[model samples]
Target: MIKVGVVGGTGYTGVELLRLLALHPGVQLEAVTSRGEAGTPVADLFPNLRGHVDLDFSEPDPERLAACELVFFATPNGIAMKMTESLLNAGVKVIDLAADFRLKDPALWEAWYGMPHACPGLLEEAVYGLPEVNRKSIADARLVANPGCYPTAVQLGFMPLLEYEGIDLSCLIADCKSGVSGAGRKAAVGTLLAETSESFKAYGVPGHRHLPEIRQGLETVSGQQVGLTFVPHLTPMIRGIHATLYLQLDDPDLDLQSLFEARYRDEPFVDVLPAGSHPETRSVKGANHCRLAVHRAPASNVVVVLSVIDNLVKGAAGQALQNMNIMFGLDEAAGLRGIALLP
Candidate 1:
């Protein structure tokens, strides 16, 4: 069994890691870290996980985490970089769910994240962990950078088209909507129920932090520079993400339906719905599945792709666990085989 450790265990993503790992047959959770909640019982804090994980939260310590075979960093953007190098030296595989190591360029990363990278040298060593696209790299990597919520949905939706020749890459637009939980468990005025509920508005119109990450992912697939106009909206729901992608087809002969079918034929979690079908976020809630639907608007050269995932599952914690399974040579769907929770 792979002894697992999680740093920052009190937030949405942290608890999510615990929830999923608790049922993972190959994982034995060793430690969970929380500065303020140190010495608190994990079950007492999260009643939902009462009988699942029976461990106490402790303060973050690199030495304590080094003992585990694998460690997941579910902390904020800058926290993972502080300890990844030491953990790697200790021969512990690392999967980070933060934005610290996602981007390849430190300048662009720093410019958007508002601080210089703490460890730029590690950038080239960290593999982008999107199982469907970068599985081979993740399997061989010691350090995996799990993607952001928005980037995961957007990249998966457009990857099939972007990699194929004769697909117009110049005019691509991703209009995404995410739940308030995507903002994190931190208290913020913008996420307050009074402010978010009954109101749907877009934040980060053209320059959200997830933009560069999404662009980086698509570019890697296309083998060239890929640019996009991404807009993220805040919905009042608690946990889910819906991304509608618009792309232009350069080749008139390209069949949008067959293209997606042939591309994701072997993928486990990516489900391509029938043509003209629309997917709802709730359809993939609480599961590590991404439901997709493709459409070609006749006479307009426009093809639309719809993608949906639970923000905390496929978008964050679940994806991190997926990377851990790859690094350990376990089945990619080990602890994530459940269906989405629907109302």
Candidate 2:
């Protein structure tokens, strides 16, 4: 079993990690830390995990964390960068489920995150943990940066079009909507039930932080500079991300359904639906799967791709577990094969 430690174990992603890890057969959760909730029984704060996880929430102790085989940082952005170096020195693999190591450019990271990077030297060394593109690299790297929810959904939706010919890579758009849980388990006025429910609105239209990460992933996959416009919205639901991608299709002969199927055929977590199928977010709820579908607008050169994933699962904690499995050479689907939670 892989002995693991998790930092920031009270937020949405943090608890979600505990939820998945508690049931993961190969994972032995050594520690789960929460500075404020330290000394509280983890199940006390999260009743859903009452019987499954019996450990108490402990303070963030680097020495104790260093003893684990792998550590997952589900904390806010800056928190992971502060402790990752020390843990690495102790021969523990690190997986950060935040934006700390996602961007390659330090200056860009500072520009978006509004803070100096703690370990700029580790930027190049950190592999982006999107298994579809960086599987081999993640399995070999000591540091893995898990992709954000928006980037995971957008990049996966646009991936097939990027590789195939006749798609206009010059202009792409990802209009995505996410549930309130994507905001974390915080008390934000905008995410309150009174404000979010029965309402739908876009928040980041000019430029969001995930924009750079999404463009970077696409540019890396296609080997060309990509032009993309990303807009994120908040919906009334509790958990999910729905990304509707628009691509300028120049090749009528290109079989998009086949392209998506072929690309994700060997991937256990990505599901490519049948032609004309529209994938719903609930279909992937509480599951570590990205469901995708392709379509062609009548008489228009526009091709649309719909991608759905549970933001907390495939987008955050679930993807972190996927990376851990790859890093430890375990079955990629181990502890991740549970079906989506449906109403």
Candidate 3:
């Protein structure tokens, strides 16, 4: 069994990680850390995990975490970088579910995250953990930087198109909406039921943090920089992300449906729906899956792709487990086979 430890076990992503890890047959839950909730039984805090998780929340201790074969940092961005070096030196593979190691350039990371990277040297070595794009690298990586929720949805939606040469690289647009839980488990006025419910609005229009990460990933795939307008909205729901991606097709004859189908045919988590299908966010809720559909207007060169995923699952915890499976050489679908929850 792969001995594992999780830091920051109180937030949405943290608890989601615990929920999935509790049932992962290949994983042995070693420790879960929450500074404020230390000594509190994890199940007491999250009743959904009552029967499955019996471990108490512990404080973040480097030595204890280093003892585990792999440690997942589900904490806020700055926390992981501070301790990752020590853990890695102690022979522990680290997976950060935050933005700490996502950007390769320290200056760009500092510009957006507003802090100097704790371990900038390791950025080159930290493989971006998108199995569809970096599967081979993840398998050999000692450190993995898991992609953000929005980036995951947007990138996967545009990937197949960017791989070929027909689409206009510039002027890409990602109009994405996410549920309130995507803000993390927090007591924010904006995310309150009375505020978010019965309303819809966009934030970070000027420049969202995920913009650079998404651009970086797309550029890597297309072999050129892209002009992208990424706008994120907050929906009243609890979990999921819906990304409506717009791209101008230079070659109108490109078989988009065949392209997407062939691109994700062997991928375990990405589902390419039939042509003319519009995927719903609920279809991927509570599951680590990205459902996609490609469409085009009548006699138009504009191609539209709809992608949906559960922000906390495929966006965060479930993807982390998938990376763990790859790093440890286990079946990628071993512990992530849960179907989406329905009404």
Q: After superposition, which runs of candidate 3 have C-alpha atoms over 4 Å from their true positions?
A: none
Better of 2 and 3 by lDDT: 3
lDDT (tens digit, per residue) of candidate 2 on 45-164: 999999999999999887899899999999998999999999999999999999999999999999999999999999999999999999999999999999999999999999988988
**Residues forming the 10-long window of minimal summed lDDT in candidate 3:** 58-67
> In angstroms, how far off is 148's CA in candidate 3?
0.2
Put down candidate 3 lDDT per residue, 1-343, tens digits, no spaces: 9999999999999999999999999899999999999999999999999999999999998888988999999999899999999999999999999999999999999999999999999999999999999999999999999999999999999999999998899899999999999998999899999999999999999999999999999999999989999999999999999999999999877899999999999999999999999999999999999999999978899999999999999999999999999999999998899999987
* Residue pairs that clash (backbone atoms under 3 angstroms), model 3: none
Cα lDDT tens digits, model 1, 1-343, are: 9998999988999888899999999988999999989999999999999999999999987888999999999999999999999999999999999999999999998899999998899999999999998899999999999999999999999998987888777778999999999999998999999999999999898579998899888998998886599999999999999999998887878888898999899988899999899999999989998999998886888888999999999999999989888888999999999888869
The total of clashing pairs for model 2 equals 0
Which candidate order results from sorting by lDDT in descending order?
Answer: 3, 2, 1
TM-score of each: 0.98, 0.99, 0.99
lDDT accuracy of residue 74 in candidate 3: 95
Q: Count of backbone clashes for each model?
A: 0, 0, 0
